[model samples]
Target: MFPKLDPILHSELRLAVMSILAGVESAEFSYIKKQTGATSGNLSVQIDKLSAAGYISVEKGFKGKVPCTTCKITPAGLAAFENYVNSLKEYLI
Candidate 1:
């Protein structure tokens, strides 16, 4: 039997966000939005979910006068992502 996938990272948008963070030290909200082609409102909601799950850390600050939100994956998140990938591989066998 295949291992269960993480419901939080299962979302396409949330998965996309995690995938992006998995490769980098961090990413700005706008960059994630641009890469995922997601609207600000939707992205914010998804980000909140990830943050609430302790899968990602969000920092709200400012680039000069403009507000900025940055996200980074936590160790727990990386483990979860790796586990998710391995579990998904079970389906291919």
Candidate 2:
């Protein structure tokens, strides 16, 4: 039997977000929006889901009077992502 994939990271946009965050210390909302080419509304919703899952941390602050949001993957997130990848291999075998 194949291992189950994480439902949270299963979405294309969410997976893409995680993949990018995995390679960086943190990323601004604009950066992720640009990289993913996702609309602000859609991306915000996904970000909320990831944050709620404790997979990522979302920080809201101001950057010289500009509202800025940054996201960072938590240790739990990295571990979950790793597990998700390992589980995916079950299908390839």
Candidate 3:
């Protein structure tokens, strides 16, 4: 029997964040918040989790004196995102 797959990247917000990061090279916090329609607090928390997991890299800097945070999906994150898609296929079929 196939092993029970771990349920990771299942939350809607986190998934959204991952999906967005998957496509972009790197995006700023405001860009993600605008694209995902997620609140600042929620996005911040999720990004922190991904960063801690080594799935994403987070950078903080200034964009013309404005505070900016950028997020990029690491190779591990891409792999997990692919696995997440495969897991959903199990449910779909």
Candidate 4:
């Protein structure tokens, strides 16, 4: 039987966000939005979901007086991502 996938990471947008963060130490909201081609409102809502799940960390601050939000994957998140990938691989076997 295939392993169950994580519902939170199952989302395309959320998975994209996690994929981006998995490769980098951190990323700015604008960068994530640009990479994912997601609208601000949609991205914000998805981000809130990830944050609420403790899958990622969101930091709000300012860059030269302009509001800025950054995201980083937590340890649990990395493990979850790895497990998610492994589960996907199981489907192919």
Candidate 5:
């Protein structure tokens, strides 16, 4: 049987995360939280999961004296999101 969209990837927050990551060079953690309308704690947890899965990269640094964290989607992540939509298209047809 063909693979379906993974449950982990199909969640609203995760899908939104991947979609936004797909568009930009990189985004800050706070930026993602703002755009997704997710709480900071929730966004942090979801991003960590994506990072562990090798779907995205997380970088921690400082901007001036303040702390900063950024995220970018990996090639694997982009491919997975595309494939997930394709999987759903099969059901839609």
Candidate 6:
């Protein structure tokens, strides 16, 4: 039987965000936007969804007069991502 995939992490953009966050302690919104090639509007929507799901944390602040938004994966998010990958491996092997 195939393991169920995480709906929260199932999205292409959301998954990309998670993958990026998994490697770093935190990342800025602009960086994620650039890497995922998602428009600011769409990225914001997805970020909100992930934040609502408790998979990621969004922080907004100012960096030397410039507004900045940063995101980090939560422990729960990391676990979910790991499970998702392992489940995929089952199918690939």
| Model 1: pairs clashing at backbone N, Cα or C within 3 Å | none
Error of 4 at 4 (Å): 1.1
Q: What lDDT is obtained when candidate 3 is compared to the true structure?
A: 0.87
Ten-residue stretch with the least lDDT total in model 3: 1-10
Q: Relative to the true structure, how large is the alpha-carbon lDDT of every model?
A: 0.95, 0.97, 0.87, 0.96, 0.90, 0.93
Q: Estimate the TM-score of every prediction.
A: 0.98, 0.97, 0.91, 0.97, 0.92, 0.95
lDDT for 25 (candidate 5): 98
The regions of model 6 sitting more than 4 angstroms off are none
Residue 31 in candidate 3, Cα distance off native in Å:
0.6
Q: Tens-digit lDDT track for model 4 on 45-84?
A: 9999999989899999999999999999999899999999
Is candidate 5 or 6 superior in lDDT? Answer: 6
Cα lDDT of candidate 5 equals: 0.90
Score candidate 4 by TM-score against the native.
Answer: 0.97
Q: What is candidate 5's lDDT per residue for 22-72, written digit by digit as tens?
A: 999999988898899999899989999988888899999999999999999
Which scores better on lDDT, 3 or 4? 4
Residue 42 C-alpha lDDT in model 6: 95
Models ranked on lDDT: 2, 4, 1, 6, 5, 3
Write model 2 residue lDDT over 7-86, tens digit each, in one string: 99999999999999999999999999999999999999999999999999999999999999999999999999999989
User: Which ranges in model 1 have alpha carbons more than 4 Å from their true place?
Assistant: none
Model 2, stretches more than 4 Å misplaced? none
Clashing pairs in 3: none
Evaluated at residue 17, the lDDT of candidate 5 is 95
